[model samples]
Target: MKIVTWNINGIRTFRGGIKKALDSLDADIICLQETKVTRDLLDERTAIVDGYNSYFSFSRGRSGYSGVATYCKDSATPFAAEEGLTGLLTNHEGPVRCYGDHTEYSTEELQLLDNEGRAVITQHRIMCQDQVKTVTVINVYCPRADPEKPERKQFKLQFYKLLQGRAEAILKDGSYVIVLGDINTSHRTIDHCDPSDIDDFEENPGRKWLNCFLHSDKQEEESTDEEYNEAYKLTSTHDGKFVDTFRHFHPTRTNAFTCWSTLTGARQTNYGTRIDYIFADCQLAEEQFVAADIMPEVEGSDHCPVWGQLSCSLLPSSKNPPLCTRFLPEFAGKQQKLSRFLVKMDQKSIQSEQRNELPGSQEEEERRENLNPSGAGKKRVLTAESIIPKGKKTKTAKAASKPQGSLLTFFKPKITNVLPSTEAPERQKNLDQDEVTSPQNPSVKGSVTKDATLVLDGSEQLCTSSYPKDNDQGTKVKTPHLTSQPTVGPSDTKKGASSGFWKSLFHGPPPPPPCKVHGEPCVLRTVKKEGPNMGRQFFVCARPQGHASNPEARCNFFAWVDKGK
Candidate 1:
C-alpha cells in the first residue's frame, strides 16, 4: 500500500477536476492540507469520489482559511476516523476513542487549539509479518508563525505541543503512527538554501522542538539535557521516538525541496527549504517500509506531494467503514435533488382534472355573469356607485356636502391684497407710535424676531434685518404696492466658463497600464502583508501564475502605484 501527503493550498482551485488530480497520484491513501473549504461550502464533487471514502475537518472560526481532508480507497478503508487533535469532537461516525490525557489542559484551551481545523486522524489495520497491527495516520497543516503577531507565535507553539502529546498517546496504545504534512520548519543547516545568513540555524524554537522529538541515530549527541528538558515541558512527547522517513532514506540529498516562493520566482533556481515531510514510527520504518521519497516535479501547488510505500498489503477491510464518506448524509439517501421539489407531469394533469370537477364551478360562472351584465367580452365602466354598495353613504361624501374643511386647505398658497403706497406712510407712523408707547412684556423675553416680506413691483423682497425696539414690541413696516420695471440678477457667465475644464480633467477612470513583455494590460493588486507598505496598490502581468520555464506564463513586470504617480 502507498500513502501520499500534499498541501494543495486550496482544494477548490484545482485545474480540470479534483478526481482527475487524485487519480494521477495513484495512491491508496491521499491526505490534503490547506483545503480552505468550510462545511457549508463543501459540494458533492469534492466530497464523494468513485471508490474512495473521505473525511474532512473544517475551520470553525473562519471560512476559506485553514482545513484538512483525507481520502481512502476501498482497498485501504479505515475502520475509524476522528477530527481535531483535542479529541473534543463527539459527532464523528465511529466508536468513541480518546487520545492523550485531557486533564492536562483546560476545556477552553483545548477548543481554541482545535478551532482552526488543522488535524484529522484515521486508524487502519495493516498486516506486518502475518501479524495484524493498527496504523494511525495523522494529517496536519501546522500554523505558520507571524512575526508581527505575538499571540500567533504562542498559538503555533501550542499546536505543536498538542500534536506531540496525541502522537505519544497513540504510540503508548501499541499502534504504529505516521505524522505527515507541511511542518513549516527546516530541520538542519543542509535543509535550507542559505544557512550562512541565518545565525544558529538549528537553534530556532521550532527546529529545536523537532530535534528533540525525533529519535537520534548517535548516542553521543544525547548529552543535551537542558534542551531536552525544555522540549519536554512544551510537548509531553519528548520520550516518544519517531523517524523522519525522507532523511532516513537519503541522508545527504541536496536541492531536494518540496516547496518554493512563487512571488520571487524562487522555483526557477531551485531555491527553497525542505519543510514537508512524512514521519513514521521507528519500528514501522525499519520493518515494513519499502521506499520513501518526494515528488518535486508535480506542479499543481507550490508544495509538491511526498509519498511512502509499504511492503506489506493491508488487512481485510470491514464491510462498512464507520467514518466513510459513502455513509455521510450528503452522499447517502438523505439529500434530495432539484427534481424532487418540482411537480411532475402526471401530478400537474391530475390537479387540473380535480379543479374542473369542483362542486362550485357552475355557481362561480353564474356569479361572474351577474357582475358583467352588459356582456362577457365588453369593457365595463366602473363608477363610485358600483365600487360601493348603492344604499351605503360614504363618510367622505357626507363630509364634502357639509362645510368641514380638509388639512390640505391650510397648506394652499394665499393671495396677498396689496396696499396702496399713499397709505403706507400713515401705517408706518402708527406702528412706530405703538412701539414707543407699549410697555415691555416678560413673556416675549426669548422670542425670535424675523424680517417681514415686502412687495416691490410684481416680485417680493425681504426687509433689512434690525433688532426689536423693545422686548414686547417689534419694528413694523408696511408692504405697499409700487409700479416699477423688472429688475435683473447677476449674470452666470463665469460659472459656465469653468465647467469645461473640470469635465476634461475627470472624464472617467484611466486605462490600465500595459506590461512590457506581453504588451497587455496589467492586473491591479493590493499588499496584504501588515507593515508600512500594507494596503499599497500595484500592477503586475495579467496572465495566470506559472513557472518561469512555461512559455505562456506571466512575466515579472511589477510597478507600484506611487512610482507611477
Candidate 2:
C-alpha cells in the first residue's frame, strides 16, 4: 500500500481538477496539507471524488488558511476518521477510535490548538503478517515559527509536544502510528541547504525536539543502554520511538530536499530543505515498511510529495464504519448545483399560476361533469353573469372575484417614471402637486402621467418610458418594460455594469505603482508585528508565488503606503 503526503499550498488552485491530480499520484492513501479551503467553500467536486472517500478539516478561526484533507481509495477505506487532534471536535457516530489520553491538556488549550484545522486522523484495519492490526495515520501540518513573533516559537514547540504525547498514547493502546506531512523543521544539518548560514543549529528548539523524539539509529561505542534511557528521559515525554521513514532507507542521501524557497529560485538549483517527512513506528518501519522516498519531479506546489510503501493491505471495511465522508449529508445524495435554486423558483411560479385560476372555473366545470354525465347530446346553457367582462362586473361579482396576486408580485421591484430634467424643467413642481396613489400599492404614492408611464415596483426606483402622443404627427418612442427574466447574454453585461458603478463609488486611495520586476499590480498588506512600523500598510508583488526561475513568479516588490504622503 502506497501512502503519499504533500503540502499542496492550496487545493483549489490545482492546475487540472483535484481528483485528476490525486489520481495521477496513484497512491492508496493521499494526505494534503495547506489545503486553504473553508467548509462553506467546499463544493461537491472537491468533497466527494469518485472512487475515493475524503475527510476534511477546515479552519474555524479563518478561511483559506491552514486546512488539511485525506483521501483514501475505495478498497482502502478507513474504519474511523477524525478532525483536529483534540477529541472535543468528534462528530462521528457509533464506535470511536481513541487517539490516546488528552486529560493531561486542559480543555481551553486543546480547543486553541485544534482551531487552526492542522490535523486529521484516520484509523485503518490492516493485515500485517496475517494478523489484523489497527494503524492510525496522523496527518499534520505543523505550525511554522515566524521570527518576528516569539509567541509563535512557543506555539510550534507546544504543537510538537502535543503530537508526541498523542502518538505515544496510541502506541500504548496497541495501535501503530504513522505521523506524516510538512513538519516545517529540518532535523539535522544534512537536511538543510546551507546549515552554515544558521547559528547554533542544534540549539533550535524544533530540531532539538525531533532529535529526542526519534530513536538514534547509530549506537555509540561509549554509550550503554542505561545511559541512553537516562538521556531520553530528560528530553521527551513519550516512551516510544519513531523512525524517519525516508532517512531510514537512505541515511546518507544529501540534498534530498522536499521544500524550496520560491523567492530565491532555490528549487531550480536543488538548494532546499527536507522538512516534509513520513515518520512511522519503529516496529512498523522494521517489519512492514517496503520503501519510502521523496518525489521532487512534481511541480505544482513549492513543496513536493513524499510517499511510503507498506507491505500491509487494508482489511475490508465493515457494513458500518465509525466515520467517512460518504456518510456526511453533503456527499450522501445527489450533489446540489446552482440550478437547483432556479428549479425551486420555477416551482413557486407554477404554484402562483394555479392560485390565479378563474374564481370558480374548476369547481363549476367539475360540478357540470359530475351532474350531467349522460347529457353529452344536450347543449349547455351560457349564463349572462359569466359572459360579462371581469373589469365591468358589478360590485357583487367583484367581491366574489379571487385575489389576483402572485408570490413574485411581492418581491418584484417597483419602478417609477419621472421626466428627465432635460425634457421637463418644471417636472418636480408638477410631481409635488399631482401626487397619486399607485394602483398596485396604495400605501405608496407618486406622480404619474400618460406621456411618461410609471411602473412602480414597490421600491422608489424610477423607470421612465416615453409613449407616442395621441396626435398622428407625434413620433413614437418605444421603451421596453423590464421583468426578472434570466438571459445568458444580458446577465454578464448587467453584472459588469453594476459592479463598475459600485466600484467607482467606493474606490479608496489609488493603488500603488506596479512592481519594477514584473510590472504587475501590487498587493497591499499591513504589518502585524509589534514594532514602530506596526499596523503600517505596504504594497508587494501580486504575482502567484512560484520559483524565481519561472516566468510567472512573484518579484521582490516592496513599497510603503505612507511614503508619498
Candidate 3:
C-alpha cells in the first residue's frame, strides 16, 4: 500500500489546487499537516473526496493555527476515528525540566500536544492472504526548534521523547506501524543542503535526542532460563528506535530536500532541508522498502510531499470502543510479583478478547502495590500497560485518564441548570436564540424537529426549528446539510465561516469561538446523556473539553444552566 505525507501550509489557499493533487497523488492514505483548516471551514466541495473518508483534528486553541488531517480509502477496514495524543505522563520519567517544563507550568506541553492538533493516529484492519492484522498510522507535525522561543525547543524535545515512547507501545501490540510527518529536524548533515546551517547547538540537539530514541544501546528486556519468556517495557526517554524509511531506501542520496524557505526562494537553488519523513517499523520487508520520493514538483505549499509504498499489509479491524491507554513506567529490580500479574492478565484477556473488551484492572491490587512495595510478593501488580491484542480494546492510559486539567470526565455528558425556571419569557427569548445548537448530532436533529417539544417547567427549554421540507406524515422531516444552508463557521475562521456558532443556539455567530475566549462566564452549551442524566442539560468548557491549552485552564467556574431563569 502507498502512503504519503505533506504539510499544506494553508489548506484554504488550495481551493482549486487540492483537487489536482488529490487526483494525482492517489494513495491508500494521505496524511496532511499544517492544514490551517478549522472545523467549520470544511464543506462538501473541499472536505469530502469521493471514494475516500476524511478524518480531521483542528486547532481548538486558535482558528486555523495548527491542525492535521487524513484521507483513507473507504474500502479499507478502519477503526473509524480522529484521535490526538494527549496526557503524556511524567511519573516514571525523571526531571520534567528535561522535557522542558516546571511544576508551575506542567500542563503546557501536553495541552499543545492534545488540543493544538499536531498529531493524529488511526488504526486500520486489513486482510492479507485471509489473515487479519492491525497497523497504526501516526501522522505528526513536531514543534519546530525555535531559538527565539527557547521554551518551544524544549516542547519539541519533549514531543520527541513522548512520540518515541508511543511508537514503542503501538509496536508492542504486534501491529505493524508507519509514522509519517514533517519531523522538522535534519537527522544528519547529509539530509540538508548547507553544512554551515547544521550546527551542533539548538536544532542539532533534536538530532541527538532522535538518535538516542531510535538506536539505544541498552539491553532493555532479556529472556531468562525461567519457564516463561521475560517480557519487559522500556519507559525511559532512550528506548529503541524507528527505521527511517527514506534513509533506509536511499542511504547515500544527497540534497533530497522536502522543505525550503519561501522568502529566499531556496527551492529554486535546490537549497532545502529533508525534515519531513516516513519511518516504517524495522520488521517491514527490506525488499518492500520502496523509494521515499521528494515531490518538489507539487505546488501550493512551501513544503513538498513525501511518498513511499510498502508491499505487505497488517490486516486487522476494530470493534470501535472508547480507548484508555495507561503507559507503564520503567519497572526494574522488582519484577517477580508483577510478572505473576502479567500471566494472570494475559489469560483473562483471552476470554475478554472474545467479548471485544479489555480485562478490567484490579484497582485494589494496584493500590496496594503502589502504596507498599515491601508487600510486593504478597500482593503483586503491574506498573504499566501491556501489549494490546488484535480485535480487542486498546489500553486505558492512567495519565490520560484524568488529563483534563483536573476537570476529569469533562466531556462525559451532564445535565445543568445554571438559571432558575421563573424568568420564562426572556430566558425563553435567549433560548429562542437561533443557531447555537448547530453541531451535527442526533439530539440536535431531534431538537429542531417539528415533534420536538420542550418541558419548560424548569425542564428542557425552547429553540428555533429551521425546517426546509416537512415530512409526509407531517411528522417526517428533511435533513438539511450545514453547507446547502449558509455555512455558520468558526469565530475567526480560516474560510467559509459566514455565520458564527451553531444556528440552533444563538441567533447570530458566537461572540467568541466555542465558548467565550477569556475571563467571565462563557455562553452555555447543552448536553443530553442516557440514564438518570437523560434529558438533562449540562454546561461544559466552550474551548473544547479534556484538552486545555494551559494549567490555569478550565473555568473551574462551574455552574448549571437551568432550563429556566
TM-score of model number 2 = 0.59
Candidate 3 C-alpha lDDT tens digits along 1-565: 7789999886777766566666688777888998876655655555656656566666543445567877776554356343565434222221111122234334554565555567777777655556666667888988665455566667778778667766766677576777889888876666767655444422366776656555422231122211111211222344445767776666657778898776435566666788899887776524455566778898778899999977656332333212211111211123455554454434443443334321222211111111111111222224243444523432345433632232322221122222332443354455552222335642332112111211111122112223333333435344322211223222245222433334345553234223344554454544442356556544444322211334333434444645553
Sliding window of 10 residues with minimal summed lDDT for model 3: 367-376
Give the better candidate number (2 or 3) by TM-score: 2
lDDT of each: 0.68, 0.71, 0.54
* Model 3 vs. true fold: TM: 0.49
Candidate 1 residue-wise lDDT, 258-346, digit = tens: 88876655676677788898998899888888899999899977888999999878764675455555666666779666554343334
Best by TM-score: 1
How many residue pairs clash in each candidate at the backbone level?
0, 6, 42
Best by lDDT: 2
What TM-score goes with each of the models? 0.61, 0.59, 0.49
TM-score comparison, 1 vs 3, better candidate: 1
Winner by lDDT between candidate 3 and candidate 2:
2
